[model samples]
Target: MSAAETTTAKVPPTRPSTAQGAGGGTGGAGKPAVRRRAGGGAALPWTLLAPCLLVLLLVLGYPLARLVALSFQKFGQPQLWGFQEPESVGFANFTKILGDGEFWAVVVRTIVFAGGAVILTMVLGMLTALLLQRVSGWVKTLINIALVASWGMPIIVATAIFKWLFDTDYGVLNWLLSRLPGVDMVGHNWFASGPQGLAVIMLLVVWGAVPFVVITLSAGLTQVPKELEEAARLDGAGSWGVFRYVTLPVLKPIIVMLTTLSVIWDMGVFPQVFVMRNGHPEAEFQLLTTYSYDKAFVVNDYGGGSAIALVTVVLLLGVVAVYMRQMLKIGEVE
Candidate 1:
């Protein structure tokens, strides 16, 4: 070989490119580094979130864990405060509650109460929404203010007010009913009777529930195309026909979502029922919430209470699952 050719072979023919430096960088070199940095960056949020998660665990998880644990053992305040040890009887609490006719009766009552409350809430809400659409802007503002006030009323205060309003002897409702034609309920002991007592509780639930449903469905109603309703009317569709055909179809998903929320809320209503139970602690009006509460607090049966609460939770989960399945089938939620 010639000297020049030998020198050229000994030295490299091409220099290494800057892109492929000591790092042996491929085209995706930046991407991998970026990915690593992005991953590290992503962990920052979770790191910041760690404290919140810990607090959540302390607040919710601990209580839930305790409740589940208690359900397997016979406990009261003594066991709760570690004053005495509890007797562990696995599944006994569950069997006891499940086998009880009273518990089953309460379950049925709770279901009925939830259904009635949900229906009344949706109906009144829908009607209120429709009414809002017909009113002027000033009327809307006033109506919305009233709704906000109603919604913002504390449960305790609302329960108190309801108790006052239906206080058999001095109640405004009884007074009003007394004045009405063919009615004689002036001094009627409203809560003395089971049917009347249940009605009062239902009224309270429905009253507190309606405002939220009204506001949410009002928003949904606004999203509905006005043109569709107008077209339906042009085709000789009355108000009912327009609502049933055009408006309802468009608002079905929203309605279902709200109904699901209402079911969840009304099913777990505690304060109102608790207060009402003070007046009449019958199987007729005793919902799961008040029933569980009475077991836990009133009777001091922690295991039984826990079992009842757990059963109520399971029922709620079942209902939510059914609702979500329907919503998912229709692609309402991702």
Candidate 2:
């Protein structure tokens, strides 16, 4: 029973420590270490996200605040903060814009244009997505490349191309129409009238927007489980039946998202119309966005422009509110 013999006897048998055993021990020595390790690991992720948060605040927050402030002021005045400053006109500008007949016309035109563009883009995009899903190899690659190429092109450049294509005289479209059977005087002035101008604008907007919808829908399509689709087919479902019952329900959320985003994008469309017709012959083809620009810059009426911008913001907010309500209802069902 000497000290050495006692120590050797006590060390004779023992169990190795485990995670649970270590944590459960009386002194709780391992718990703090475990927590520290977890906290240290979390820091990396937050560090990685820090830059993005900083950029978002710097790039988006500042400009948005300035825009809101600008909408409340008169033109040619120094802004109380950064950039321009204008006199406070209260709601006078808003009232003036609301009273203007042309403002309502532009608003209606914008809504119709955006609505039509979203519908057409969604339809075309969905069809293209389904078709592409069924194909593979080189053909799929080619299609993807073409779509991405169009999407990657600059908006101004694309509008310029469309402008040339639809030009009234000495344009390729007019030239092609001249050769068609039973068609004489084929060189129609595409932007000479409101209807024609709006149609051209719609084409441009849809063309730019369709690729985005296609990319988003195609990604969502990839997430859809193939077995469910196969099961529907095995149950004597035709293509339409399969799509209506199986695909549509599954894709509804994404479709709604794409549609909402498309509407927002088309509503703010300015460059195409501005570049194409300079707000058109008599500004008949002017949209809310272009109208705002004209009011502020063209006519040097900053107050009216601010009022127009404020109204546009309200309209957009209303659209967003409606979408949010619809989304909540959809969520409730699930």
Candidate 3:
């Protein structure tokens, strides 16, 4: 072969561009360093959050742990500078409380009171919301201001007000009743009896709690499409029918939420019962919360009080679980 042709054959073909090389490198180049900066960046937040987590552990977690531990121990007498070592009694305290007839009675009363208060509050709240919706100008503003003011007042203050209102001798309620025809026993001590005291407490609870329900339901009412109600009315549905078929279905979720909240709040109510009756006359009007307080503070029975607190926690958790399950079912339906 000619020299030129021989030289051409000896030369190798031109290689592909550097970008086209396998793994983005020529044979001599090392693999590109794998960057892991994103992972380090992500971990920076958790590092920053470590202090918050420590603070939470110190503030909230430690106290809850202590409470759970103390619930198992008997209330020991105070020492020279601090509380003595609690008597370790396992589940004895719990068993004693569970078997007590009085405890069971108080539980029943609490349930009844909570149920009654929730029902009354929801009904009154719905009515109030509807009324406020229909009204306008000064009246609406006035009513809203009053409801908000009542709701904003401290529970202790509200309870004191209720106590004075139901007072036998100097109460405005009894004084007003004295002027009514055929009402002779106007000076009757309302809190002296269980039923009357419970009634007063229930009324106060309803008054305070109704505002929350009203606000929630009123918001829900605003979200309900008015066209649906108008269409229902056009189809010969009366007020009741329109509400039943259109408004209620739309408002059901909010109603359920309000009812559950009301139940939870009323179940734990202590101020009203404590300030009004002091669980007085007997334990007839005693609720679980007040009973627990009396056991812990009044009678100085910490073990029994802890047991009651634990039971209340369990019942409230059960209620929350049931509500969540029902909400899940509702979500599934939707």
lDDT of each: 0.86, 0.83, 0.83
What's the distance in Å from true for residue 57, model 2?
A: 2.8
Clashes of 1: 0
1 or 3: which has the higher TM-score?
Answer: 1
lDDT digits (tens) for residues 1-334 of candidate 2: 8999998988967776786677786777797898899999989898999999999999988876776776677765344233764677777777777788988889998899999888899999999999998887688889888989999899899988998898777778888878889876466888778877888889888888888788888888887788988999999999998899888888888887788888889999988888887544357778898888887777777667767877888898888887888789889999
Name the top TM-score candidate.
1
lDDT per residue as tens, model 1, 1-334? 9999988889866888866673574654666787899999999999999999999999999888888998999999898799999989999999999999999988887788789889998999999999999999999999999999999999889988988888878898889888999999878787777667777888888888888889988888888888998999999999899999988987888888888888989889877876666644666668888888789988999899999998888888888898888888778543
Better-scoring candidate (TM-score), 1 or 2: 1
- C-alpha-based local distance difference test score of model 3: 0.83
- Tens digits of lDDT, candidate 3, 79-115: 2126676678899888888899999999998999899
Q: Of the candidates numbered 1 and 2, which has the greater lDDT value? A: 1
Question: What's model 3's lDDT at 35?
Answer: 34
